[model samples]
Target: MRIELVQLENIRSHVKSTVPFTRGFNCLVGGLGCGKSSVLYAIDFALFGDPLGRSYNYLLREDAETGKVTVQFSQNGKSYTISRGLKRRGKGISQDFDQLKLLEGEKLVASVKSEAVAEQLKAITGLDKDVFREIVWVRQERLKELLDAKPRERQKRLDELFGLSDYEKAWSNLAGYQREYEGEKRAYEKDPDVIGMEKLNMEYNQTAEEFSRLEIELQGIAKKLEEARKTLEEADLKLKELEEIRNLTEELKRKEAQLQVNLTNIEDASAGLAGKIEEKKNLIENFKQRLSTAENRLNPTRLGSRK
Candidate 1:
């Protein structure tokens, strides 16, 4: 893998910087405090995010709200671009917001947040942060530390560099499994059941008897469960019928109340009608008495006029 371009914004001392590299031999030649190391750190930030041992806040520029790093690299003839960003949480505080994206040409392939982004970057590059820092981009100080390491530590580092760590881990796991197997074998040999076939047969008969008794008990329990289920179903059905009866009773009561109201209204109307009929009868009797008096007076007047 070769880095083609690195872009940094508000990262360390770099406000905005772009560094490009050629195909073969490329070196960053600059004086002290000229951001040469910051460029490399920015590349590391783009690939693997913040270093595990160091605080992420140190990567941010002073008084900057956000920082970003973008790296374009070529691996196996395919070009990939990775971008990462961080936002400050408060004044003089580390950024809480971290995001990363992996793109092939113009198409986005992976977008991850925080720690997952580092994992995805490792998967894409086939090198973790520590391995990349130690083997691919070893600083002068780190190289000195490597030289000064003990023999065992040096061998461990060599194993990591050559990808032999996985094999060492596999061998270690195999030894552990072998020890476990041996221990199990010893335990089996000491077991009383391993003494003779007669003892084994007796134990087998006892286990079979116990299993048979348990099976019988399980069958009884199954029957009880079925019976309980049927009883529950019956109870549910009865509850439904009771609910239906309760609804019908409420309907009947409402209808009875309406019928009582209608009866009261009819009785009131009948009483008023009877009182009007009695008044009409009294008026008719008074008119009949006035007519009889008028006829008697007229008959007397006619007889006097004839004389």
Candidate 2:
């Protein structure tokens, strides 16, 4: 799938920038440290979720990450808009996935991810993180190095042309089958007259019975193999889902801890505020008492102040 366009805001080296890329030969013409590569990584991360980092700060620009990065782009004629934020207050990143509708020629081709507004983009795209990186996109410099390689230096190039190294496997099975058939034919030739013919008939009937029994066993084995594969797949999915749930639970605990810290801060702030308020109230009362004292002193016992 080809990504046709991308729009990034608040990403590294881009405070608020909207850049439209072409479907072919789009070069980010800029000097070093101007965030040329950052744009590429951001585009890959937004469209495919193949970010080059294990953490939130891995691919993002320096001194950033307090704010969010909004990315809008189109892939394989379908458009997508995603807004992601790794706020300073939280341990996990907040993600939003949006499916876009666009007209392809005269018909409207809707994006398939419209069903879930909030999910891992992997769920929306039906692509795992590794597959997206391998099939859809590649880094610019790595592409150049891969192209300049010799045939012998690369390991997998030869395997693609020729089949697997265990190429005699099917041939070996066929040879064994031929040997068994020849032995059966020679055994039939070793018999003689009408009595021998009767014996041969008995042997044929017995072989047919054994063949039918083996066929049933093979069928059962095949069914069990299919079930085994399905069970393996289910187990893998369950493991991944459990991992995600664990991560989410950890995040929830972090949020709860932060909330408790905030409550404590509010309590301390409230106590300080109360003390300041009472101090100001006492100051006003003192001012009034002093004024009354001065007036009595001026009148020489009008209000009975101490002489």
Candidate 3:
């Protein structure tokens, strides 16, 4: 993994710093206590988070309440950024897990999870903390010691760095594992199950036949269930139709009752109108009789007076 940039905020002697690195062999050349090593520490913290022999208090600036480190790097032609933070807690400083993040380009890969970031970084860079410290980021003082060391010691360290030791250890452990496996194999060979292999196969076949028969029965039951479901659906539809007819019948009954009431009211109104007509006819007949009497009396008076 190639580091492209390292950013620091309130880290050690630097209050704020942004150091950009190029593609190949970039070195930090500064006087003593010039915050050059602080940048390296920040990069490491950003990658692996508070490694062994380092603490949040060491990375965080003295008297500073908070600190942050952001590292941008590229591996296998894919860019990634790792950000981590530290905060003072009471008398001690601790990682601000809320600020832990790993991003690929603008896409977030991990957030607020140190373990997730470490795993992703391991996968991307193919370097764990040990390999990074031993091989990738060798200290200036440790460089002389590594160079002046014996060939055997140097080779051993390099083997550990390259993970050859793990393979060697696995090879060494395989002898014991093989012995255990052989013992278990012998025990398994003498077991009743292994001895009755042919009988077990026959039983398995019988069980398989029984399962097939059951499956056929289940299919038949499923067919019946489907037919029953269809019949139930038809019954429900018929029930709905009957309910609609019942509602219509009740509505017709209500209308018939209202029509009967209206017919009674019309009959009562017709009887009252007939009674008024009869009274008017009687009054007319009485007025005609009075008028006829008055005419007859006037005619007689006229005749007598004239005679």
Candidate 4:
């Protein structure tokens, strides 16, 4: 929707001027006396039901003058017209002090009923003020206000702009899951490997069995190693004793060889001496035999003297 012309009668400084507008980037530039911004306010009134949520006549050209505004615009490729008239008597009283007329194409489909007719006019125009503000309503002053806003106010504005409500819901769900995970962690942190309370007693039985097996194996190995070490020490002692016996046996064999040689030499010399003695005895026996023979011959001589 786009507005082309806005006629303000006794509305602010517009007086009776039909302020022309453009479809895009429209600027109403003039000196301070000219109603440049007042023209913008006139368009604002036609769409906003009331310009500033107050009486439309408050922005009229003069206090005593009757206030009326007419806006011509294009909606959905069709030309439309909306008109509002304001009364000055009731300043803040609730009464039918305003009127609205809407014309669609070449027909007046929206009829005027109650005088305070901004709502009825909107129903005919199908124009949402919020949508209009988004596209066309802006000011440098408003930009400054937003930029200079407080941190909390800016946060609210940013939330409204980016629609962060869904993130809040997701965070709540994540928090719920985190709480559940923490609960599960706490439950099983120190839990035994046993399956159930009834089966838990089997843990002690199995552990005791394993402990007995390990103890038996360890004792066997210890005994084997101790026996091996003791055998090694005993073998070392026996080897030393055998070495001493071998040395003594070798010495005794050498002494026996020397004693046997001495005994053989003594036997040879003594046998020679004994043989010489026997020969001397034989010679004495031969001399005795010769002397006996001579005596026998001499006995015959005594008888043979006279021969």
lDDT leader = 3
Best by TM-score: 3
Whole-model lDDT values for every prediction? 0.83, 0.62, 0.89, 0.71
Question: Residue 160 in model 1: shift from native, Å?
Answer: 5.0
Q: Write one digit per residue (lDDT tens) for candidate 3, span 219-257.
A: 999999999999999999999999999999999999999
lDDT of each residue in 23-66, candidate 4, tens digit only: 67777778996777666666776655555555554566565446
Q: Is candidate 1 or candidate 2 better by TM-score?
A: 1
Report how far off residue 113 is in candidate 2 (Å): 11
Residue pair clashes in candidate 3:
none
Q: List the candidate numbers ranked by lDDT, top first.
A: 3, 1, 4, 2
Q: Report the alpha-carbon TM-score of model 3 versus the true structure.
A: 0.52
lDDT of 3 at 75: 89
Per-residue C-alpha lDDT of model 2 across residues 1-307, encoded as one tens digit per residue: 4455555655567666666766677777889878787676676555544346555555544555443444555545565566443333344543333323323344534333433322435444565545455445556665565577676644354344344444667788889999999998887677566558888889999999999999999999999999999999999999999999999999999999999999999999999999999999999999999998887778866545753
Q: 256, model 1: CA deviation in Å?
A: 99
Q: Residue 246 in model 1: shift from native, Å?
A: 99
TM-scores for all candidates: the values are: 0.50, 0.37, 0.52, 0.45
